[model samples]
Target: MKNADNSRRAFVRFLAGSPLFLAAGIDGKSLHRLITGSTRDQGEAFDLIDQVSQDRQISSPGEALDIFDFEPVAKAKIPPAHWGYLITGTDDDGTIKANRDGYAKWSLRPRRLVDWSHLDTSATLLGHKYDTPIVICPLGSQKAFHSEGELAVARAAKAKNHLQVLSTVATTSIEDVIAARGAPVWWQLYHTSDWNQTRAMIKRAEAAGAPAVVFTVDLIGGSNRETMFREAMNDTRTCTNCHSGGQPRPGVSGRVDDRDNRRKPAFANPAPGAPIPEAGPPTWDYVKRIRDTTSMKVFVKGILTPEDAELAIQHGASGIFVSNHGGRADNSLRATVECLPDIVKQARGRLVIELDGGVRRGTDIFKALALGANAVGIGRPYIWGLGSFGQEGVEAVMMILRKELEIVMKQCGTTSVRGISPAYLASR
Candidate 1:
């Protein structure tokens, strides 16, 4: 076994060196000849390469130059409101741009000769193993996008052997989500002004078998998502779930319900009202409350500062998710990717660090891992996939990303995700 492994690695290294071997023009017999001539473990390597070559054809562009043109097509197909929510970052969206720009500052230094035949992109987090280092980031009210909503996403994640983080504002209930997927799910918690509600939600998530609690720290107050609001206004109907109990009534200062509901004509909007009862900002004490409530692993999202990262660890957070709320919270903040290295350094070994934002390619996944992210959360792309083709769309998106990651690993001369490190990147 050891010798076979070593030979596989050597053959992979040889493949990595020969650019001609990767060309589309190379016939299978010619490639077989090249491999057999180049390495002692030619037979085994040839078989493995043949499998990869077949799979590679699925992603390879034949008559087209732009393989990634599907992204824009998918983007255009999404509803205007959903598209706005997915694409726009908070405030001025500076942080969103920063996320993409940060990737440009780093370059991958592909190794010429290294054994990468047994590459695995699988990752284990919070004691749970996943097929890939990618997880579906929690996005709220997916039901608005499709009928399957969170359930569809959960099914897709289950099929791909990936993790799904259930948002506090998910269209489906936690129990139903678990029932549909029958897999451990991560819960994204939004801190509410009502402590009792927060505690209740946490207890419910635990009872439902959610493996982790990801506390979203940035959206204490509602964001100025003008596009979503505008789209909502244009629509003739409102989502019953969004207007259900717990949400503040429109133009009211506190929660409203069916018993106290009053009908105000769309044309007769003249009542002056106090500010709505939005969720108050959460402090470290809230983190403590979360820690006390659940034995599940805790991860704090929306962390952009080393100071905040330290505070999160000190407050008993098991992990930190570097995010800028997908550029929806505060546009002035640095993109989550830009903040990852520092947070990873500050937390040291005290916490596991993961990140999300502006990730569009498998190379982006590789880049984040190389820059100290234990894993990455994909938000909009999956949604686009969901909106476009429902479960099949989601499956297609996952397949694309996984294939991309495999190809990237093959090209970079590293087979295992663990082998991806800062050494593979240039500090441009």
Candidate 2:
């Protein structure tokens, strides 16, 4: 099986680099996807489960796997609707497109003649040291994408010693993920209509040994994802695997609960007998509420502004997850990377700033750090890896970033993750 998969990858690579692919009018970038754009997934979608390929656990051939490799393979493997759900951003893909351009917004100043040997990418977040600043952001409904869902991702995180933030809507239970990986995982929370449930979740994370809580606050309403909706309507993959194996079918009434819950403000209406007459999205008071309820460090995940970052710090937050909810919440004009510098400037080292959205490469991670991000969060890349090769695929994705970051660090004379400063950046 290992030989076969490697052969397939090799064949695809050769085909794409061949004159035939280019003669077909495929650009150099699209050639790889065009060549690998066939059903290579060993698993089939059904009511029962996503079958694990015999090669699911096999390590890559030590050759780096990038999106060009992962994306096409995943596209061929996973169901179209699931793929669309994982990749699509809000209305017209404005934010997603903008995110890709964010890295180009700044230029790195490479310094030569420095002792660039033996680089370090390790970073410390909230007193926890990580092998890399690349964190796995909380993505929900893993079973929706693959049978392993959060479990596979956790396995990869464990192997890499990278930090992973689990979603509340994750198909794999929080306890199960921690049990599978035996690694300290952070939890991402959303205020449901039931504040009791919300509080219970926080308490659970603490009980489960979560060191921190990333309470996402950006998604107060839904945005347009016409692509996902269209794909769901057209997807041929059968049901029975939906809702982490509970729902009888996929796309019930075309409802995407994970996304729907995001846009709706948490605790939008007041609980009975509450002091507040009416309700809106949970405010800093809500931040205080969660902080008081748990012993764990608190971080706000959806911050895009200095004001919000300030409120999070003042409200006892240990850090800020500077994001645009991966541009899934609304068609915000600015990408999260574009928004990072201002937020970092405003934060003034008062908060541990992390960012997500458009972080597909190692250079992107380096830029975020150079512009004041303490860490970087990834959402789609890992999922693309997850669908392509299960746990090993995800591991390869991280390895790719780590390897690329090493190249950047070595080139830019940034010897340590801590050494990455604004001095390395020249705003474009």
> Best candidate per TM-score, number?
2
User: Per-residue lDDT tens digits of candidate 1, residues 1-428?
Assistant: 99997895676566665655456444545554556565434544554555444433322112222224334444445555455556655444567678778778778788878777787889999898899999899887787577888888888888898889988767788777877777889998875554654566677789889989999878665465543444444344444544443222233221111312222111122224432333556679888879998988889998888999999988999998888877777775566777888888898778888889878778888989998889988888788677756776676787788888888888889889888988888888
Error of 1 at 379 (Å): 0.3
TM-score of each: 0.74, 0.79
- Candidate 2 yields a Cα-based lDDT of 0.75
The lDDT values for all models are: 0.71, 0.75
RMSD of each: 15.0, 9.0
Colliding pairs, model 2: 47-240, 220-263, 221-263
Cα miss at 281, model 2 (Å)?
2.9
Rate residue 178 of model 1 by lDDT.
79
Which stretches of candidate 2 lie above 4 Å from their native place? 1-65, 237-278
Model 2, 1-428: lDDT tens digits are 99987996886566546564455454444545544455322111110012122213223525444654566567667777777778767665678878778889899899998897778889988777889999999987776667787889999999998999988767776778888778779988866655665776677778888899888876655467755665566576654443333322233322223433332222222334434322566668999998999999999988888888888889999898988877777787787888887888888888888888889878899999988888899998898788878888889899989989999999999899989988998989
lDDT for 211 in candidate 2 is 91
